[model samples]
Target: MTTKLPAAVRDRALQIAHHEMGHYVMARALGFVTGGVTLTVTMDLRHQGGACITLVRPISSIEAMKEHLEARMMVLLAGAMAQTFPSKPSAAKRVDKPKATAILKGEQGAEQDYAKIRELQHLLRNIAYPDTDPVSCERIAAQLKAMTDRVWDRTQKIVEDQAEAIAELAGALVDGMVIVEQWGRAADTYEVMYTGPMLERLRAVQAIPSLCVWTDSCGDAVQHWK
Candidate 1:
């Protein structure tokens, strides 16, 4: 009564699901609230990509802003880092930093994430040094590279430590998508899969309180865990 998806189609969808779950898991683990996660599948079912809706609170102080930016950088980097894991949990047990970094660097899916990271770094530099005069492009490039390296190392560590949780979440995502056709939107051009089950799994994994409330403000999601 139903057509079976081709192996390539299913594998592409699975990869997108894993990538989005990576972001969602890291956001919740870092005490950020997510509106939801989405997996978009074309009608032809050949191309797929996903998005994770992460929310942050507004910050008033420079110190708060710096911390917020750094945390967000970690969240952005987490998606690519998580994608480095083997689809099989058994093979994923080993944490290979070089492999993970290589994947992060080479992943075209992560280009936008890396762009956002650079944008945040620029904001961080300007806000932290508002009075400083403009430096040569070379110096600025070097400084940003140093900042990226520092944050990348930190994000890598977090991803490594959370490998078990990430694997669990990614596995759930791949399993959940088998019924994705049931959730296709009226638009028909693209299908958006629901993330309620994924969120529940994340909350359970992190033992986060069920006191979540929806708001554009950041206090509850950022401070409640602290």
Candidate 2:
């Protein structure tokens, strides 16, 4: 017998899928090795909020680490960014009063993402400018935001292109056929694993391309799709 999820449950599943897919797509674009992406839903009140986790390899060097953290921050922001900046709208359209207000208000999990971004920013600033004063942190934050904004358009394109893959992953989650016990957790929360050939299939079906082209400076200066 097929089971039907409640409307709320279904909506939440889609939300989690998009959020998780954002991380997965960005990580791959940045050439990070991902173990997989997992989406777990539980009935326990303590864990009522669903989670979408992307497993990635550890960074190897200080410079590489900074780039990795920045990439991760952008991926973290991508979920809430999608909620506020729909693909149909351009940056100009995003300036409308209602949309701008909604973006400012943010969406679920946005606080957690922002907190992570702030932590990464603090670390980056400390390493890059150890002698910087307190006010410089705010300045650094703005620069980080500006950099993130520069890539928002490309991020939206990736999200749009990978929509079918995301939905497929979400459907698999709802069907309960892809459960794996989460690592380091005593509780029996299950998550779907998308790794190796499975992940390649997802990317292939979507024909997703790199989100940016690196320049000689090693910065993502161009957004190219295949």
Candidate 3:
């Protein structure tokens, strides 16, 4: 198929790619095992979407659990933060937090992501405070919101810092050379494994210097899952 396409189509594809990469990049940085990232956009607009599947290892300690939850939230928030990228490269560093936060608060495409974050938040809250008393529950809710906001801020900063990396990966996707979506797969099915050279290229585009440290910390958790 010819790579040439309308400008609108290309823009949408890049946007979707960036959104999924936001999650994929953050997840990898946090040592979460990613199944892969997929982007599908056909003439049928109803089926246009992308995903980055991540797997967090089971934790033996409460501390690990908390860290994992916070990491997951950051990963989730990264998607929206990426989508809000300014069209001008020079403005990437100056991304307005208020506008980006608005997108995260209730972006149309991010409902599912926000929902997932909420569920994770709920889990974290329950783990942190098991008490069912009304007063304790209210206080815990406030504390949890604070924690969530902190994670959101951290995620936004990471996205801002990695703006170039995210754009590079998205461009690779738009070029249809490195990572191309499987048009033959069913629209609803979104499972792709980024292995071999493809995975290497993806890593090359996004330099996560801390990946080693993160992996070392959670490497044991992976073995436990198997």
Candidate 4:
């Protein structure tokens, strides 16, 4: 059997969702509104790895710039922490050991049927090592705690109000679209289009995987190869 993930994972895409959502909500709580919650969307129904919510921090007055670089970095790394978080909300159960075993054993069961064949293109490939190991999830969470706590009520309210629309937007983005702010303060408003290189070589790795890599690697996987 391919790794089924937990059936519960289907409920929220993946465990890290709340973490990604936390950044989205907390950014607003911090009042950095260069643009209100910007990024593309996804609806593929796969776990989207962990970056389900793509939140761009607002750029305060450019003339007299004050940078929350640290804050934003913390926010950027928050979802991964959330995904690996051991809390009740994030970790539903222990690792799917049985499925993980099958995956390692070459079972290629139904659960992994789709992923196995798809990953064939990447056989023997090694993902880039994370620069920061021994990283603390709580440290990341601590940086975000203030914003999340500050805007907890408001953010959760926004989530509840727009849950359906958000889901649809994610689906639309997966189909082919970019979710940029129309102007400003247009909550969840997005314009779909096709632009950019549509295929740009990564600075890290010059090889670009066409449209397939475009979606899968967040356009960054090829950076090392470049």
Candidate 5:
């Protein structure tokens, strides 16, 4: 039997789903092979916020690796972005005004994501502009945000397109009724408890062609490999 989830738990799960799904969808759209996504609940205070995991393919070269790093950073940022601007009002409606204000005041994973982006900037600078001074870091930060902005629309569409799937998965996680079926080293399948029309809706969304398109800025920087 599936356990009933409290209002807070349900909301938290949906937040995690949107965040993680952002990574998963973008990674796939960028032609990076993904190992699937997983959502889990935790009692650990540090992780009580919830966990969403998306496994991606390994990078092959330094130049190619940099592109992958940038993509990953954007994916990471997508989670917090989704939280800040949820696709559906219901996802965050239950949050109290004060708590909602707090969420808006601070992003979900800003610190970690920013750190990763900074690290990626350092690596890219070393390769392309090693002689630059500290001020260059500021420029790199701007460039990173610009890159993220370029694809923001696509990310939003993914979140919106799969909103129901995310909610379903979130509900499953909250109920502690998720079933995992590993599929070799390629992908991992998650079976949620809920069924019926919602599943059909998710399949319909998945059937739609990808709306992701590379902006000129990112297109020039990250070569199309697939």
Candidate 6:
């Protein structure tokens, strides 16, 4: 299939291979398993969530919690970060676009997902999106940039200090990708297993249903079932 990437994305496949490798391995070193990096998808090939590393083991501890939250967010930002490469119009344009699957969906899907993204932006501004802070909008934007920056920094360390773990986790995630989406394991792969401490704090200490569990599509179809 044809794509709209710039002509200057030298070594297109190589950069994505390493970028994803960084995320996949970094998550494992932080204690969560993830899919191995892929070379098949590159600057030219990556679309929305094109270079995702299926997270494994989830975030369930303190250090692991911090690392996981920062790591995944960084991985989400990798697409934009990578665009800061051989060109400007491409880099600037790519950086401005949303870096998630919902962003790539059609107009209605983007609209549907806008609520969540707006909520994310709002919480990012307030830090209450996940109980981080209630900073002003400027501060929130700064914090988001800072957090993603940290993720990028730590991702480098993860690649350097934990290459083997990343390779292993990536392999495991890729092996399980079929079941990753099929067996109600999005949480296990993305949401559930990677729960941050704030989530745990809310659930265990605060005793709230902040993150409800909908085990099935059919359940979602019937509001009262869950």
What are the RMSDs of all candidates, in order?
6.4, 7.0, 6.5, 19.0, 9.0, 16.5
Candidate 1 residue spans exceeding 4 A from truth: 1-6, 41-45, 93-107, 179-192, 201-204, 208-226
Which is the leading candidate under lDDT? 3
Best-to-worst lDDT order: 3, 1, 2, 5, 6, 4
TM-score of each: 0.72, 0.59, 0.74, 0.27, 0.54, 0.35
Candidate achieving higher TM-score, 5 or 6 = 5
Q: Name the best candidate (by TM-score).
A: 3
The 10-residue segment of model 6 with minimum total lDDT is 205-214
The per-model lDDT (C-alpha) reads 0.62, 0.51, 0.63, 0.31, 0.47, 0.35
Q: For residues 1-226, what per-residue lDDT tens digits would candidate 6 score against the true structure?
A: 2232244332333333333434433333333434323333233343122333455645455544443444455444333233222222222212223343323243312333334333443443343246554545676677766654544454333333333333333233222221123355332122012223322232222221111112231234332212
lDDT tens readout by residue for model 4, 8-54: 43333323343333344333333333222223223333232222223
Q: Per-residue lDDT for 136-217 in model 1, tens only?
A: 6777777778877877776666667667776766555455543343455543333345555546656445563222111233
**Candidate 5: tens digits of C-alpha lDDT, residues 113-157:** 556655765565566555666667687677656654544444455
The global Cα lDDT (0 to 1) of model 5 is 0.47
Cα error, candidate 3, residue 32 (Å): 1.3
For model 5 the TM-score comes to 0.54
- Model 4 alpha-carbon miss at residue 22, Å: 2.5
lDDT score, residue 75, model 2? 67
Task: Identify the runs in model 3 with alpha carbons over 4 angstroms from their true place.
Answer: 43-47, 56-58, 93-106, 135-138, 177-197, 202-206, 211-226
Tens-digit per-residue lDDT, 18-128, candidate 2 = 556656655666555555555655433111222334546475777666666656665665555434333221222121324422432453444666677668766765676
lDDT score, residue 189, model 1? 31
- Clash number for each model: 1, 0, 0, 15, 0, 10
Model 2 residue 112 lDDT score: 62
